[model samples]
Target: MRSEGLDLFAHGMIGLNQLKAGSLDSRNSLGAILGGGMDIQIWHGIYWRAFEADYVWAALHYSDVVSPSFPDLRRPYQNGVRLRTGLVFSYGEKKAAPMTAACSVQPTQVMVGEPVTATANVSNANPKHTLTYDWSSTGGKISGKGNTAAIDTNGVAGGDYTATAKISDPKTKHGGETSCSAKFTVKELPKNPPTLSLSANPTSVQTGGSVSLSGLSHQSGQRSGQWRQLDGECRHGFRKRQQRYAEYFRRPTRTDHRERKLF
Candidate 1:
């Protein structure tokens, strides 16, 4: 009984020694390689056959192992050795699209001519997605376009005009179009719409009730506004990111680069 107890203790000791020499010490020094790990007897006592598992902090792997020892291990007997051979397993993941850009098309839906401004408000504040744009005219008579570059709806034909706007990132297909195209029916002009007068009695004219009218029609100039960042955070990691995107169509617009610190 005593001898058997000693034998079990020896096996446990041998296992600990093998563990230290094999990976634990090496792993501690290799924190860069994920410091935590464990070795377990995956399949043991199968007639001299034992499959050991190596859990390296994140991944699980198994290996066939052989531990050879000697009876006279005073100075640790012969060349005792523990051997390991790898087995196989696999893993993978699908990445989701990050939020890229936001846009606004004035009039969103419009008739030709009048005037239209397509504003593509963009942001990559999150995990740095991508922001992009393109512009076009629907009616031939109406020809005038611009983006953050320059917006001008000078002249155009009369029809439902849409300023197709698309936004996305470099990785996948994510786009949307909208229009604030000012629509015009080109109505006949009217004079003063009327004038001003005071009357108390309907037909008797009591000189008390008063009426006044006025209106001025003209181009409100292509829509205008300034771009601003609403949120500022770097959760997935704040990095100075340069993202590129491909569009079915591209427009050469004005871009400004300055010594601006964007945190």
Candidate 2:
């Protein structure tokens, strides 16, 4: 396992002093140590401590001065440095799991000129590191950043295509990359023209009487209607009304006895 963090410790040390009479004495003192270091893995559960350096501070009291005639001769405070290195044995250290990515599209099917969105879901990723997302497609123009992208289906053929996303962590050196793919289809628009039908309520009308005419039109999966009146072989007074699926025309018959033709 590789590890690094702050260290807070209480340390004790013994100091030996030599007197002018060739005798030796010892003194004990306590101090606080604060530092940090890193360990690199050499094998399973075994690591080498690269380096550890700490700042040491302690106060050594030798004698007390009661008069201004004599100054203190002992060092009141002392600063020191400590360096160390060793091997570390760790137990039950857990390694990070491999990264995994899953891709999804908002619409599995769409018509030409429409847009589709692709998204990425990642697992076992390090939250402290920044992630990069790269996107590509077998068909259409795909563009995005981060976790989501937009696909332009304009001018693309009507068939199946794949959208893929690659996720990567720049901070990791190994097992930091993964990819996923999702399939989608594009459909072409209908090519047939709209169908229309026209009918009259009465084939023949008496002079000074009224007649009703209607028309219907159908296109694709929708229906719309529009109404208009035109002068034919016989002139007549007409009025129009619109409806959801049909159009109606109301006209007053004229006294002229000529044969009337409507188209």
Candidate 3:
């Protein structure tokens, strides 16, 4: 394979030469061969092939003896180096690139003024490529870096919002841009202070007798309040004259009266 499959070679050969006149001689000689050379692909297959070549190498010598004196005539080897060329074929199924990106938001529901974070997962992207991130939301200010983004819902309207993340390999020639979306809900904080009203099952109760005092509000959840009991003597003359309720009440003495907590 020297010369990268292109070249020529010459060498010497030795053989025995015998004459019918009972004269034996040894033929030891050197020679050279020159011929136009080319290689052609003979057959094509997955693993094997066939090839062929044609060439000639020979030498001729003459004797000047006028009488029959020489024992035998010497001849050069006639066969030259032969080469074979083959063809190869390979077959296989092709596969597509696995470029993809996905996104997810934690705690899909949040109150206004709370911060929510979104994360992106990328697969089959070249690590050597420079990646870019784009984040967008329907109802919040989203700030992004890398594969993560922060959603600020401080002034955002209360409703279901959809957040999207697009991851791009800008350096890639095909420009692999994959995106995914996640939905979240934002609830506005209660604006109106709780509107409460108090009432008793029995407006008038005898001394040492208990009456159920109930309160109502617009809000839901646990509520706490301090309860104080008032004596009839605390009523002013104008309230008494007008048959109105007293403005100020007495401090509660029992633990059960002051410890008013409800849900």
Q: Rate the local accuracy (lDDT) of all candidates.
A: 0.30, 0.68, 0.59
Colliding pairs, model 3: none
Q: In candidate 2, what are the lDDT values of residues 161-216, reduced to their tens digit?
A: 99999899988766789999999999876554445566777867776566676654
Candidate 3 regions exceeding 4 Å error are 1-93, 199-263
RMSD of 2: 10.4
Residue-wise C-alpha lDDT for candidate 1, range 1-263, written one tens digit per residue: 11110111112221212223454232111111111112222222111222332223211112223233432321221223343434322234223234444445455444333444555554432234343445444532333333342234435433444444444344433332223333323221222221112222233323343322222212122212222232234211212221111110022212222121111
Error of 2 at 150 (Å): 0.8
The clash count for each model shown is 13, 0, 0
RMSD of each: 25.2, 10.4, 16.0
Model 1 segments beyond 4 Å from truth? Answer: 1-94, 98-103, 107-115, 121-126, 139-151, 171-263
Query: What is the Cα-based lDDT of residue 224 in candidate 3?
Result: 33
The regions of model 2 sitting more than 4 angstroms off are 1-36, 42-44, 53-83, 204-241, 246-263
Question: Among these predicted structures, which one has the highest lDDT?
Answer: 2
